[model samples]
Target: MIRALVLALCGLATAATAQDTAEAALRAVQQLEAASISLQEAGSGRDRISALTETVQAYEAGMAAMRDGLRRAAIRERTLTRDLNTQSDEVAQLLGVLQRMGQAPTPLLLLHPSGPTGTARSGMMLADVTPGLQAKVDVLRAQLEEVAILRQLQGDALATLEQGLAGAQEARTALSEAVSDRTDLPRRFSDDPVKTALLLASTETLAAFASSLAEIEAETGAPPAPDATALKGQLALPVDGTVLRGFGDADAAGIERPGIVIATAPRALVTAPAAATIRYSGPLLDYGNVLILEPAQDVLWVLAGLAQVFGEIGQVLPEGAPVGLMGGDLSDAQAILTESRQGAASTRPESLYLEVRDGQGAVDPATWFAYD
Candidate 1:
């Protein structure tokens, strides 16, 4: 999932850059005629006006054509991410069926199967309780192949987007140079303030668009989550950071105890202490990017930091798959993660958050992890 998401984001970032380029080109086109007229009235050279006008018109047309394609690229990225997630889920179910038939995970150790027969043989016996389990597994294998194809498609689209962005940037550079060459024009427009403001606005607009896309992705449902029991003691600390608050820690005066706080820098990668499904993924009041992982019915874990998220909710994560990147941007607030509480105070921190919950209660993570 992390690889898929990273690819998706790379695509999105490329698209966003392309979109900005397109927008800038369009803006230049709109500004061209007025600028030309003004330059004419200001007694600018005919060649200067003509050059500016032509540049603007050309950029407008070029970027206009690229806009739809850029948007499509973004959409394609989103689609592939969503599809891969779904396929992974379907494949997992099929694997389950194979496991029941006593033929699951057939030696990927020897040779990776690329065709149907190898897949069928994998879950031949100890099959699932459900009918058509073998067929379903075959279908899943096929779908996995399809996922690979979609990934290639996504990569191609991203390349195209990158090309377009490069072209648009080149065009902008040309335009800026042209603008600079016309020295007789108003000097004020060439000042730092206007350019800075314009640049900021453009960048902010791009950031907002990216955030919107992320929100949309978040709204989408993910594949089947991992069982809490599956994660119990499967994960271990990856770094050393302090836990400012304990699981269910509250002062006698009623101050709430943080689930787990592992102090780390921005962009530190958070991983699952054990294999599990993400229970929560979002920024809570103060915890910048918080992830809750449940290791079992009586166990829950929380991870928080100031940074980008590495996984989505409901994602079945492995023991060390990046869960989130840590950041230190939010001051006076601590990021955290933990397992189900068994009721005790925790004293260990590796910049990784740990907590335990037993019967919906807080347990000291230190002893359980040490004992485990």
Candidate 2:
């Protein structure tokens, strides 16, 4: 009986040892998984930090560039003003001389009731000045043309400076918001990976791509944005500049398009005219990068001629939020293309083409946008 009791105690001891070993192994595995999860989180955090750093650097560089551009524009403006004033005085004097000559023609002067001596004297004076006067008149004409061109250039420069300053301010605000957030927002809509790949590969043209994108978006509806119809004629403009072309204005090709073209500063920021949801944001043919915003169920706003675009399809944007930036002066290739198509070259670097469309057809945006 003593031997049996000892054997039973030994068996219990073995069982306890086995249970402790199992528990220890399970804990080891759990610890490894936890460490792996922590490593993954660390990696993601680092990547986000890097991205934010890049964004901040870019904003700073943009601000510096805008300041330099403004300074240069101001100097040019002053010089043009001085030159124009000088040219204006010269032109006025030339005009007065021409007016006097016209009033007293040689024939009328020769018939002066004074005498032959008076006629000879007048003829001699006219002869002496005629050659030099004609030359001066030609010079004045050229100077006047130059002055007009300079005035136009100065106007454009001032406009560009204004737009650049506004864009820089907006960029700073956006950067501040991004820095405050630890996580970055997704840049675009998250579609099924396989379907998106297939659709992208199959698309042959911009139109086809747009159609496919529409179908995909229909399958996954977008979040609602604020309606903008009620704010018509009260909404602010997307950029700072003058309207280069009004809605329905005829192009060089004699085609009256349904959109307005705003001539803005080079690399100027384009903003949302009103609260809206992005429908599409990317390059589309000759339009360059474009952003399509849906301000209401039936209303769509299309902004084209962007050098770079921000945000993504299906993203909600508040009024005055930056959407993209206007392109710089045309490249050599672009210049060639423009000349070939229009038979003329343009000096304007950036032009934002804005089109508003409803369920029926294209609509004028001027009525919806504030001039100021």
Candidate 3:
């Protein structure tokens, strides 16, 4: 009986081993399915990035149009001012008559009329005068007599128009700068030119690493990723922060420089602002810490300065994900770039620098962001 019990226990162990093998196989199949899904997501991201680019271009164009409109509007504003002034004088004279009627029955001007002709003027002519004349005048005259109001209305409208035009122009100016800087951003901000060269060299080395797990799905006839055609070039605020500074030279925290600027909280989370992946992340001399991202196959996204680099080369990320934290360690140039990159802020800043390059030449960031 003891011998038989031992044999029975050995048989049960064999059965358990078979069950574990089956479970492993099942889990692997599930992971393969998940990888296919990830591939599809990647395709969607690529399309989204494309759309984002187009949207940015459109926004820039819109801002350019607004700048022109404001110029014309500014001229028209003068006309409104002059008209308002003439109307105001008429209203003031009318109010004087009403004020006199308060103390006593004011004589009607026509009834008490003393003309050069010396014609007798009756009280019926006066009937057209006095406080009772409110029916004929008050509201219209109040509206008319208000030269200040008319001038103010023109002033207010002009102020609003100017504010919008300024923002639009600012965005346009920054994007234009970026276009010019596209070819040399790395070398411009590198610790040394050699380091910038090394960064570019490393980028090519990553091409061999693109063997995404989508290959298995390709073999299995699963669908490819969806293309997001609608999202291209959509203009959106890169961050939700207040405008710290804007394009042009301005001083803050005792720093000085050229280019558009932005001031954000140090250590605040930075994001791609569009779907993208790590193109380059490492030390660039003046950038302190740097990340180069590719939002589209043809376009690059650059962010410099960080407390830590959280992503690897070729890893994908969503728009506005935490690219890095501000370590209170950006070069003045990088700060300027940040402000310039967000050119729609109030008050031009000289402390920070910003630039953008579209293809070969400079375009305005304000126009890009504002157009859409």
TM-score of each: 0.30, 0.46, 0.32
Write the number of the candidate with greater TM-score, choosing between 1 and 3: 3
Among all windows of ten consecutive residues in candidate 1, which has the lowest summed lDDT? 332-341
Please rank every candidate by lDDT, starting with the best: 2, 1, 3
**Predictions ranked by TM-score, top down?**
2, 3, 1
Q: Give the lDDT of residue 43 in candidate 2.
A: 56
Query: Residue 216 CA error for candidate 2 (Å)?
Result: 6.6
The runs of at least 3 residues in candidate 3 whose Cα sits more than 4 Å from the true structure, single-residue gaps closed, are: 1-96, 105-270, 281-283, 287-289, 296-299, 304-315, 322-345, 348-372
On a 0 to 1 TM-score scale, where does candidate 1 land against the true structure? 0.30
Per-residue lDDT over 1-372 for candidate 1, one digit per residue giving the tens place of the 0 to 100 score: 112222333443344444554454445444544545554565444355344434334433433333333344435445556676877876677667557547545465234366666566545533453456657666656655654544454445444434434443454444445434543321111124453344434543322322222222222243333454533454455333455556566645776653454554332334556666554556544445556665544355655453555444445555544454444432110111011011112223224445455544556665345332
lDDT of 2 by residue, 141-201 (tens): 6655554543343333334334434433454455344434533332235535576567656
Which pairs of residues have clashing backbones in candidate 2?
A: none
Which candidate has the top score in lDDT? 2
Model 1: residues with Cα > 4 Å off, grouped in runs: 1-235, 242-258, 329-354
**Relative to the true structure, how large is the alpha-carbon lDDT of every model?**
0.44, 0.57, 0.39
| Most accurate candidate by TM-score | 2
Could you give me the TM-score of model 2 versus the true structure?
Answer: 0.46
